[model samples]
Target chain A: MKILITLLASIFLFSGFALAETPEQKGLAIAKEDDKRDNGFQDFTANMVMLLKNRQGEESTRHIRNKTLEVEGDGDKSISIFDRPRDVKGTALLNFTHKVGTDDQWLYLPALKRVKRISSANKSGSFMGSEFAYEDVTSQEVEKYSYKWIRDEDYDGEKCFVFERYPVYKNSGYTRQVVWLDQKEYKILKIEFYDRKNASLKTLTQSKFKQYLDKYWYPEEMYMKNHQTGKSTLLTWTNYKFKNGLKDKDFNKNSLKRAR
Target chain B: MPFIKPHRAGWTLLFFLAILALFRFPVKVFAHEISGFAAGEARLFPNEALFPGQNDQSASFALQPEYYHEFESGSSFTFVPFLRVDSGDQERTHFDIRELTYLWLQEDYELRVGVRKVFWGTTEILHLVDIINQNDQVENIDTEDKLGQPMVNVSFYRDWGTIDVFMMPFFRERTFQGTGGRLRFATPIDDDRVQYESSAEEWHTDWAMRYSHTFGDLDIGLSQFIGTNREPTLLNGTDSNGSAIKIPRYEQIKQTSIDASYVVGEWLWKLESLYRTGQGNENYFAWTGGFEYTFTGVFDSAMDFGVVGEWMYDTREERATNAFENDIATGLRLAVNDAASTEALFGWVQDLDTSARFLFLEASRRFGDNWLLTAELRAFIHQPMEDLFFDLRDDEIMQMELAYYF
Candidate 1:
């Protein structure tokens, strides 16, 4: 009888251990859990702020006054005003981003007296000579890269889903990237970038998640650091709104000339 | 004797076949991009009468044609098939596609490939951009033809700049020879205006590194190159006088250079210095500075004016008898209403010697958004070299061209 009770206890413990998951499956489960946190969001408009820090320990803050108009199925557009650095107070940066095609961009250099088009295909280049590429400021869709479950771990007391993403674009400077999604907020908590040589190059971290819409969660602050170059770009978002009646006609090329 | 080896001839034949295989077959094993395109351009070439003894030019004509194309993203696989001909000279034709090759990018980030162009230069205006050479005339030079290798090369392109190693294995016949064993040949340039020159059993490899950076309002780049050229004759040490000349089958040449430039507002400044060290160690350096200012018609913002001046080294100096020398040249350009449908430009080139001058003028008018008509004229005046006084002629070189771009 004593032997039978001991055997039963052993079987029960073994069954519970079998139910415990591996790191990869745990990561996928956490990702699925996080995806459930965002379901009803369709459109959004927001004013964002950014704080930039250099490797020399010098810090500069930029308060961007802008209106972002994003559609549910279509891409997003932003008309931004540089409010700081008295020199560029009135300068504007306009971006007309598409879902899968090339994005048309223009910067009005008050000095050059002309609106110059940014024809560089390397959108992944450093933004304002910072660690973050221009693509990072834009929204992340589901189709830009292929993902695989990497591992499951606890970051800052919150269980996280870590997945590796490989860029599908031919001109991408990064070969692969690892993303950490929060289990409760579904927001991307961190990202590690691997360059073409499969070497770790940079990392992006998100902090201070704020719930804007009832169903949407957004990071109020973000930071990106280039491990190789020791450079970094920090961003802060403020006053985010969803579903403001912005139409397609407002994003026309002719409108770009009058954005300022 | 029956068992003896087939000797050097057999080895040479095998080597030639191996090189041919490297290009004939698409070694898909080597990763590369393959894209196709269609392009056509109609250029208005100015025409003029040749000197009395020289039959070089007569009437102006336009050559326009649509052609297929194959090109790589980088300095790799490129194949362009096109033909151009002039109306005045029906018998003379120009072939555009001269060199075609595939690339094999290696593991060390070096391009171990076949048929490629090695570029060396950093400024918007390149003084020593001589990796691949071309004719002085713009119309006669084809874009596909490079002063590069028909053989093989390994190149590394980094964010800062590039480094290239190359070898040219080909054979050609010598046509003309002068004193000091100096030789020249009538290069086999096709009607398409593509030119390629190679030495008998000759091989050459070029190695160079370039770095670029930006500081304050300036952009700077620096490069250094060293290489050697091997020839069967150079090693044979045969002199024109039938005496044994001590010449290496190969000779060494090294060039060290620096390019620095600054841009502030509407002004631009650029400088280049090159030091050549070898059998004839000659150091050649050139400097150029330019400034441009634009004024909109406070009344109509579209109207603008541009003025540019450039000074180039002439490379010829009487003091340097043991080495090749050149003279310096200065050019001035003036353009008005450049953004309008109808635009005009006048240019002048002055040789420092004051014995030679070049005058150039051109005009273009755009009809609607699709069609454009252009005409150009050029005149070369050689006061000292002229044996006959055909100072000027009417209708010397007149040509018109019409083009549509989509």
Candidate 2:
């Protein structure tokens, strides 16, 4: 019980309850509170559609199904199954995300009945020819980034906290990301990404929030626009179901081959 | 010589019955989907044919239709029927069931029954450990095309690893091109007159078990198979028409294999080795190992280039069954990360002892959303008279295929 008290005392002291808290401390406190609120959902399933558009106004689409299981002390485990474009249908990808180390990923090709291990260095690559990077769509653990509070602002007339977070892991495509979160519930509203040269690269807007189980809030749609490339991707999430009683056994390499 | 055994008809009847039984399962269907592709291909052989009754050009069409159904209890059934029609070779015009399986999946264990295709290997150039399915030689010379095998498989997922046990009751003979095909020997392969070392013949049961696990970045699999050898010994003989021919002789053998792949950063190192016994005094060991280094996002563009190299070695160097006794295979893979998903592979294989080499190029690009265009060029160069592939010296060809998927 003494260790528990020490942990609680640390969290209480660094949570900005005391005076003279630095900007970094307050930013970390906000992130920790946000992460805590989003925890304990157990498991969830959803259907996602990705619409990719190029500079010439051409468009293509992909259909995917997702299942995520929250892990206690590490990152969440997830699986994604492809269902569209005809050729790549029934392909599945399984991922094990970690907080401070390289993540594990595998891809299952239905035609070949083969599963291949993917390198973690490919986290920054485009996710199936879309504008969204692989890391962007994966689970976001609080320890993956370092945060600093910038200011108190209003996002569309609502009270919000604007902060800049630097990626803690190497091989990230971005130098820093400016995040806008609602101060009332700590829900993410928007983000601006800066490239390695410290130039504006992309902006992501998450809207159409809906509260599930009267506690967790999720966005129905997310749009990302790349400024220099004139390309964009719109992700639409539907059929969200939570508390599906998924177990750890459903997130292994064998599950990848059985995802279909 | 004799003709094809009477068991061929029995296998086909069993295949149809399996499909019928799977389709009649009692379950609440949550989803039903259908998708597949239809393709047309044309090939042109530049040089003259090596054997008589052979053609310099060929045209073919292929169709594959897939049916999938998922039940509310987390069980599924899949059916895929395939057919091909070739204008030059009558034997190439054939029909086969690619996949007809009913899968019952639980949290920790799963069961699969019917005709299915399973691949197990790590090396890129060769698939020494992938012995579950019979190669469809009429489809491609690379041995990548497979005919589904009838089996009952059970897999258990546990903390230690995944274990799969298979029971296959029927044996399948590898199909060969007819006399009119360009890539053939001076003596046609008499697939009809097949001989088996076992008295039980096609009724011989095959058993296989595999244990696979992942350790950090290293993934490995160890498998053992006791069954009829897929690679047959071609016994030289004469047909009833007094023509020189080769007869396929199947023998019962036992094999053990290990395949491993370790990924670090942009490098992937792979190895697959196998030891085959019970094949008389011809028991041998062979292995292939290689490394692939990828350069991703080259020059800030969404393009990936990978260099692959593998060295193939065999214990019985000159007397090995196939061509890769002692050889080196190198290739380059290019993936252009675009909306159309364009990709290309160029490779070369050379024998270490003789002046035999094979070079090939394959490229494919998606058109719109449902169509794909593929082109391939294969050439055989500098083959000595004593080389095993000497018959292929005049069999170089250029092929193009267009496929429409739905």
Candidate 3:
């Protein structure tokens, strides 16, 4: 009887230790769930307009065509081709994001008729003089960050799972990012970026959520406000198409010159 | 002859207008539209002309329009015409078919025909492997502008790499500044007295092949060319007026080049090397290697400071035609990632073997949405009499330009 009691007690203790979830585990689980829900979007194309606002309230607009392809077991591949602003017309940027390492990027200059591979060290730098950093424009993979569940909150009249994510890559400009994901659809509603000093720097909010193909949820509008600079950027997306049968050849370096 | 003489300029204007009208008509019928930019440049200096009958100031304007139409068969036709008008230098005024090509894209191969420009190199200060297009020297000395070349190009893309083959049917002569133009040699080049090593002269057929690939953090390109050399050898001759002049002699040559770039963090290492023969029955090698490091968000501002250092070398140091042998070029690039897209660059190239140096500064910024304002200054200092560009030692000039894009 004494031996049996000891064995039962040990089994109970081991099961308790295995089932109890820590904050880190809970955060990772939430992120994995969210990522799993967004799978099966093989490829997509969308048109976007970037509206930049200066400190004095002056505004400028840029039109771009964006295409993204999903890679199994890795980060997505993306390409952005500028169509408006005649000076920058025919310019294209191709990106290949990696799950655990730095992303690769290339920019094609039409005037020079060459493709230049750019360094990814300055991921924190502004992208095309906009509030969005180079890192922000990249597709976020689950392995890019380490997450910790903060608390549940109400955002825009919907229940959200609040989490703080620390970047896993080196030389990232932000110390941490606080994100609010809708509990039902696992859609990102808001994100707050903290600088390297852990000071609040910018806030990005998304609205007009739309479901495409009855499975993927995407926001039609995104706004980023720089609190310290009194500047902002608005990205409005339209003409979203999915599963267009885009092949791997469409996202390579050669495609940059032929993006138009 | 009288009717044509009276309407020469007007006819040119009408011809361009008619081309624009043709391009505009397709925009309404096709899904894609045509676009272009118009720019004007003015240059001034405080010193007298380096040569007699030259001006210390000049003005020029340029118009570049592009049109592309895609067909249902996945083939496309592209047309780009460039026209420049200069009030100071007659040779600088020219027209070019920058690109008039038909491109057919296949699953693993692509073919392009007609006139186009192709660039190949990794160095910032010197482009040793970029030989597909002829240099438009009358426009600028920077070698950034090119006159298009007519060729039939085929490119094969595979998992191994990309292989490109070019069949160039015609050779284009490099344009030179006239006697009345600024930055000219001691004597003008008599174009009429030009000679070619090939019996076919400008009709010589040239061929080239290139293989390029990118793996991980490194990009590499290897190319071979057998054709009329882009760099000409000056042969002393007498003009029709019985005055001594330099005649550009084009020679058939074989060249092999390699270019590579490696990116690590914020630093980029670039190298370009070439080996050429069949010029004056001599063989030589030239190379340029450099590194660029950028510091982002300098001084807590939204600015980037990039420093570049390049070393140029040639087997025939003093006798090199490019004048870049045994030289070092260092430059600074400043970028303010602001709404105006402001950028400034300062560069200095000094000959290691001679007391020759060149300094250049350029800054530009956009105004509103369509206008761009640019300022540039170029100065030469302490040039030896035997230096290639010594004749233009006193041609320090500052220029400003305003460009409107649509």
lDDT of 1: 0.47
For candidate 3, the per-residue lDDT at A48 reads 94
Model 1 chain B weakest lDDT span, ten residues long: B176-185
Weakest ten-residue segment in model 2 chain B by summed lDDT = B1-10
Q: TM-score of each candidate?
A: 0.42, 0.93, 0.94
lDDT of candidate 3 over B229-305, digit per residue (tens): 98899999887789889999999999999999999988899999999999876689999999989887788766888
* Model 3: CA > 4 A from native: A1-15, B1-30
Give residue B259's error in model 3 in angstroms.
Answer: 0.4
Pairwise lDDT winner, candidates 1 and 2: 2
Ranking of candidates on DockQ, top first? 3, 2, 1
lDDT of 2 by residue, B140-225 (tens): 88888988788889999888899999999888888888999877667799987899988888779999999999998999999999
Best TM-score among the predictions, by candidate number: 3
* lDDT of candidate 3 over A86-119, digit per residue (tens): 6888899999999988888888989888888888
lDDT winner between candidates 2 and 3: 2
Please give the distance, in angstroms, between residue A98's alpha carbon in candidate 2 and its true position after superposition: 1.3
lDDT of 1 by residue, A1-260 (tens): 99999999999999978776655455445544554455345445556555555567665555566656665554566666665433344367767666565455656553222343443245454444345666666545455555677766898778877788776654566898898876666788899988778999889899998877667778888888878756567887877777666555344322332243
Superposed model 2: Cα runs more than 4 Å off = A1-19, B1-10, B13-24
Which candidate leads the pack in DockQ?
3
Give the TM-score comparing model 2 with the true structure, all chains together.
0.93
